[model samples]
Target: MPTRTLAGRGRRFAAALLLLAALAVFAHPRIEAAGDALARIDKAALAKLTLDEVEGLRSVLELRASWLVAGPLATLERLARAGIPVEVIDRDPAARWFEVTIGPEPKGDSRRPPLADARGREVPQLAPVPLEQGVWITAAVDQAAGPSTMPGSRVIRVSAAGGPALAVAAQRVIQRVPAARAEVRDDPRIAALAAEVSPDRLRTSVEALQSFQTRDATTTGALSAANFLYDYFRGLGLATRYEDFTFPGTIDGVRVTGLPATNIVVTIPGSVSPDQVVVVGAHYDSFGREQTRVFAPGADDNGSGTAALMEIARLLARGPFDFSVRIVAFGAEEYGLHGSRAHATAARAAGERILAVLNLDMIGYTDRVPEDLDVVVDTASEWLGSRYIAVADKYAPLPIARRLDPLLRASDHAPFWDNGYHAMLGIEDAVLNNPYYHRATDRVETLNFDFAAGVVRATLAVAADLAQPSRAPAPPVGPSARTGFLRSLLSRVKLTELAWSPPSDRAAVGYHVYRSPTPHGTYQRVTGSPVTATSFTDRVTSAADQVAYYVVTAVDGAGRESNYSVEVDDGTIRR
Candidate 1:
């Protein structure tokens, strides 16, 4: 009976051994397949692809097994590339699957994966699959990796429940990757070429050119076009200077000394090539009544151009450029380009290197002609001039017509061309349009502000495309202090009351009233000086005299003048 029991025990032992052998064989292939799949992964490719692609790849990897190890490495790598520093946790085979945590990697930390729960206890929850039946046993990884480990990593663990998904996520993260940096040359020649093509710089040059204007000759119109340019350029922080040229040939044989024809010039020093100059200019004078009385508010005639120049200067002031830009506001243009002639002549005599000349004249008016006005490119300087027209057409809101007119001799550019410089004139088709030309009605209200703004914008664009200099052009000069104050005060101060009033009981001065037909026109002295009287009985005029304007200036005993009272005008008087 003892022998029989022994035999049975042996049989049972052999059977158990055989079963264990078969299980080992079945499990080996699965382990190998999983290992091979993980090994074959191209980590670099994983890093280059977007997150969506990586997720899809993870799905494909997961199909081969029930559980996989993954971590937050993929996200860490992306963040690192974007200038964040990070560290990845290591893995341990003893803990069924690899483990990983993401955060700032500190020095002296073990590169191997952790294998315990959050409280430094061994996480035996990780499930191990049997080689034969694909059955998994659960086990937990230790969570005492460090305080630096991210909270998201812990959340992922809770969601994964320490299963294949967690392993897959950890594996996905383990494959940390980086993006490839693009290679580019930083050669000085290339930088120079780039500087040459910079549109902002060129625009600055154009703006600087716009900063010269003609000065008013009298106190009545306290500011001249030239003064406007000065203020504009100075406001832009440009180093501006002037050249006064005398046009002494007398008007009507009267010796007119210092018939001031001046050119306002501004220079922007270059960073690399300061010797080469990009030139731009416009005339600042306007034609109207004599240069003595009455204000010739030449706001649109060339003020538009001058103002545009000033704006350019302001734009170009903040630049790091490679070439010099020169702006000139030529005076005596209305008197026939005398100032420009002097400037161009001097430049030629000095053998100055002038690349291009952009002349802006009458750029404010946009009344007649096709709504699509042609931007005339002088046939002589078509190479650069055509580019301006083309750029304007390509970028400008308005259609720029490219015309090669034979009559481009309207402004300062003519003198530059006569001096053999490359020059182009920017003008409206003034020959056909300009109803207010040299007329008393040429006020600011008569001009199109929108059209003026467009021209300024277009001119700025063209200038930007050409000079390729750095910095914004300056603003055009404004009216003088006295003029500005007077104008501002006059504009706001309406004539509230104009009834003639008698002086009070105390002895008072006599009142001499003057009158003019227009705001800025001829004024005639009234016939009588009324004494301390409120009402003036005009004994000289009949009731038939229509349209009377009156202003009262008080004259004291010593022939001193008081402030002129408010002006009053009555409609045409009917007898």
Candidate 2:
């Protein structure tokens, strides 16, 4: 590494240390060899490139700290040892990027992003949290101050909790700094359960999710995705429901309001301690930068997460747990985590005993270049985060990199943490922010399904250990299961009156009515919402003569749905 500054000018260094675009796609021996050779570039290698070539390197490298580095992972250790001071400033895990300030700032075009959000509001570089004294997360820095070329302009203060490397890194780049490290081990009981995870199912689920045009919070796609998950869980005999909330008003701390968002919720009740619960959540929403109506194919942003969640649901549904496991396909997470905030707030208000939440955000991306898993943990959920890491050690092949991002509140997991629940996120390498993220290019083809499966297996390990699932009967007991239908015709319209005895169970809160032309499979809800009373009037106008079969299921306070009552019909239709 050369240490020199040209007269009246900062050194113009080329950033192509290693890992260029073509090399980034494959993890081959040739690429590895090139990276090794490039890592130790001396005066001899540096002289071969002309100044013009040095300037052209910007296409492949980025100005990070004082060094023009290929990737943070490839350069962080070298920079640290070279005695080059590095200060990480602003970082967006969703965007999979970070901004840093290094002393002896290099001269090129300073990559100071115009700091403003969608509404033209200045994005804060730092803000004080009401938590502990001297703690601050990145908030909007003063816009008037503009850009400064000073050595420490990018440095800001931050305090975080997690592994030692993370703690140290947090302090090293803070516009100001705080404390550090952690380790985890395996639980074999969980590994045996994780072994049953089917990678084929995981890929199939992702493919199904990507088939939708767009799952934006404001679009009908959101509802459609939710309904699909609802039916899937319902078929598995698990308690299922749709948790709905409007956006803007739904998400906390966000000023925006009145967008539609719904979370598909499914629960596998604990056999013994049914009240104790564990949550495995994933956001199903996708964004395309003002292209909600068009194709925003969110295959990786969250289609991967949503798909992985389904695989977990399918696996866990086969067994009953000691602690109830609720798998939620959260909507509007792309819209500032509105769906989750709504659910968590309600869960907290109702005094639900949520033991832990494992959120899988973007687990389907791997440059295939760097196979790493970034388990993001905050100060609040360090223990839960460590447990997940230990589980990954036992069942997953992806290398783990624990990052302490106390201020990184970018996913569904954050809302659970706010509601005083232990939550952690499982994601692809945070450093390798997928190139196709948030774009129309983020399709299934861009995802590494094999890598995603490993992440799911790791998550399944965590869920199995925490929930400790067993088995349940085909249909739950203690609910009154009787129903009848009466038909009447007026004008050209046919009306069917439906009635059912209330479930004898003390916990019964409401009943859900389902109707379908066939005996099984696709069923539609006749009632707009859950009916509190046992009787209801049904209206239908159809000239076609065909029989419609109906069934009713009772729901309890904990969202448990009883077995369906006997089917009722509007007298067999005569053709």
Candidate 3:
């Protein structure tokens, strides 16, 4: 147990301020290391101190036997003077917290479900405890179908991929959040970057890893996989290293200790703020049936995602960004996310400023006609998911299913979320539509390259956007404007058609059209969003007499806008 003393008034005040700052920013509030022993200050001693001292002590000390007091610091100080003993209860050593995604209860099974995967295997759902919104700490067993002890009447302990499992207990569930639509827009630079993603390259990377057979953390193949990834990144001339760790857990029925694992880390230092990081990570290790670890070929399960990470690294390697980008190939993810947890914990301790983490788990193997993807995030990181969805729509254009549940802790992103960092999980299909989730037959051939490439492109676009694209697209040229009429179902609509030539810079993605009453007057943006094409159509009151001056500017992949093109008139009535 850790202990601290509240000796000096100034020291106590500083500690209180630190605690308040932690509470404001982070969900898991923690005080800085205090000392080796707890302060034994009695109620009478506290009564003699000032109001600031009393308030400081309240935050620094733990209450014993549960005493409740309402209102502000004044009330607390009064109560302390009235002889309330301020004692600290020893913290529980066995207490552990998990942040889990809640699905409906399992059907026919009398036992209430613990955290599980799509296949109903018991998986650890470890994350930081969300205190404001009460969560389940212990596994509920043998509970009936009335009401859940979890807050907001939300279901608990089911996988995000287990859609069928939720249907069984639909009657008992109070609420189900409907999947929201992804925002769509066009960016020529993003589209260009996305187009650069090679389906063949993705396949080659996946196949190379699949050839290793088994990448279990304890197996020799795991070391080979790590070396391969290290060499791959090193070949790119990026700063790369192997982050090593030791883990202890149960395999079969026997307890194992000090098993070694390796995480491959690659860093691309930013041109501007190098300390602020954008993380792209995926687990490289895999698992199979209990009997044999030698034949596990985890292609679709994680190979697709790992390949996506490599492809993104390749795209971003073209140039440096405003923020540092860190790519990690995590090991031992199947064995309770040991690699990610260790990394996230160390990052938090070191005060690494992480902008966002895009964690890919299984981003291939779709059976449907239109390829779809699932993005999972917690309450705090919903913006990160929204940005991912928006970028996917613009860059990849695919069906997306979004889940805002922190309880979905099956992947590497969970550890980042646990440490109070913004992270999201991008998966091919959360429902586990693939037949070979954890089987030995999981191979590269089973993965849909079309779907995998699109996912990779989307991930690349977003990662670049977060890292802040360093170069702005060159300004567009050859602007012209003309009036036209369109026959709609309701009536004839008059409009102005603005056209421009593409920029010389390959980074240019789209154009933003602006309008002005006079050539010398203020130009207002006419288009709501960036237009993908070089031409734009703006609806007008009348095509016959309406006159407008127009200008266009080029927008790049990072949403940076270049200088406006030379002004042009509507031609109906020249300025």
Candidate 4:
């Protein structure tokens, strides 16, 4: 009987161990690395420190909690224990985590609860712990958790996307956190805070060129401006390029052929969607005769606009965008939009998808008439321009005038519109508004930086919205076997090129080049031998043969052909 009982006890113990293992798997609890770090921290020491002492020590400690999440809670608890009048922030049971705030204790006479519980007794101090201090705490949690637990406080599930509930919770948490004592010097501890707390420096440098004036289109002024723009863009780490367009024109009754018109274009490539483009442009040329020459200081006429465009380019180059932003300072706007017209025509012919165009012209002059005039929208397509205006108005501090103008035509926006694109023009009101209109007095001093900043801010908002990345369109499936083979070959070859090193890593396994008539056409291998070359240069003299698309495939030792390199149409190659 004793032996049987011992065997049964052993079996029961084994079953209990198995049940514990099953429960462990079912719980699937994950204490984050951060939680482990928090566990190691000396909570007792933290509890003993004063608000100022804790903030001062924050810089040296490698705390795992976010300031937005932990600072308020710590401050509230510390102040409360120190006998400072403070409120303790409550936690929502349905929430994944609790936020704590410190603030002054609430005052006023107690009132009986209007709604009684089962006992018909007055609710006692039903208010959630009020963290009335300015500090805020934010705790992130899994979306599945409902609201967290906190007695006498409203329960809310906070989302990471900064939803209304989250914002309210954050506000409550901040109110509980104790306000830091004012310091004489800037605290290095909080230097890493966001721009809201510590604003970022202006990325673009400002240089004043006193008595700066330029001669005619071919003068040093035009070239210096172009060089300055190019260097500025390059300094900001942007990929810069220039396009030269020649046009026949009759200047002062003198027929001129092949008049050189150059445009300095800087491209900020997108990270995800590089195909879409947003262009900001201004004219670099000037007209009007002065001092035995056409002294087109053009400062207000276009220099101001040009300068603003350059500054915008500088800012964009310092940051990343989801879509390409091309800043083009066009030449010869005074000569009837010749440079812009040429660019627009070429882009249309090449099937360029231009999302928007922001044209800046004569944006200087502090006079209230032009500087304060309503931002004009295109009468032809008010919907496109009006939408941008509305967004700007929503975010901008000042009111934006959305009026249609009849006199604003034949500008750079027209050429863009002609190509079936959405375009808008931003210009100071030109109708007897500025007394210094196109005069030498329209210098840098005459320009209102506040107004320029407003315009720039509006432009940035619109451009940023348009340039945001969209879901990539799904590619078609079930293509022919040959097409799939070509695509695979291209992908492999491209990856190899990207991964290849200097001194040529190509072995004698050779490569095979294929050609296709169209993007969706069948591809035929051009050569049978494994082309052992890293690059295949087709020296075909016939223009017809040169117009085909080419892709390269590498072969391995076992005669296995790798996927094709990046697709390229010889005719569409830029360089």
Estimate the TM-score for candidate 3: 0.57
Q: How far is candidate 3 from the true structure (C-alpha RMSD, Å)?
A: 18.6
Candidate 3 accuracy as lDDT: 0.63
Error (Å) of candidate 2 at residue 447 is: 1.2
The candidates, ranked best first by TM-score, are 3, 2, 4, 1
TM-score, cand. 2: 0.52
lDDT values, one for every candidate? 0.44, 0.57, 0.63, 0.45
Off by over 4 Å in 3: 1-136, 139-188, 290-292, 472-575
Against the true structure, candidate 4 has what lDDT? 0.45
Worst 10 residues of 2 by lDDT: 55-64
Task: Kindly state the number of residue pairs that clash in model 2.
Answer: 24
Worst 10 residues of 4 by lDDT: 31-40
Prediction 1 global C-alpha lDDT: 0.44
Model 3 weakest lDDT span, ten residues long: 165-174
Runs with alpha carbons beyond 4 Å of true place in candidate 1: 1-225, 249-258, 289-293, 368-370, 469-575
Give the top-scoring candidate (lDDT): 3
**Tens-digit lDDT string for candidate 2 (398-467):** 6777766644556888777655566788788654468888888888887887788888888887787666
Q: Sorted on lDDT, highest at the top, how do the candidates line up? A: 3, 2, 4, 1
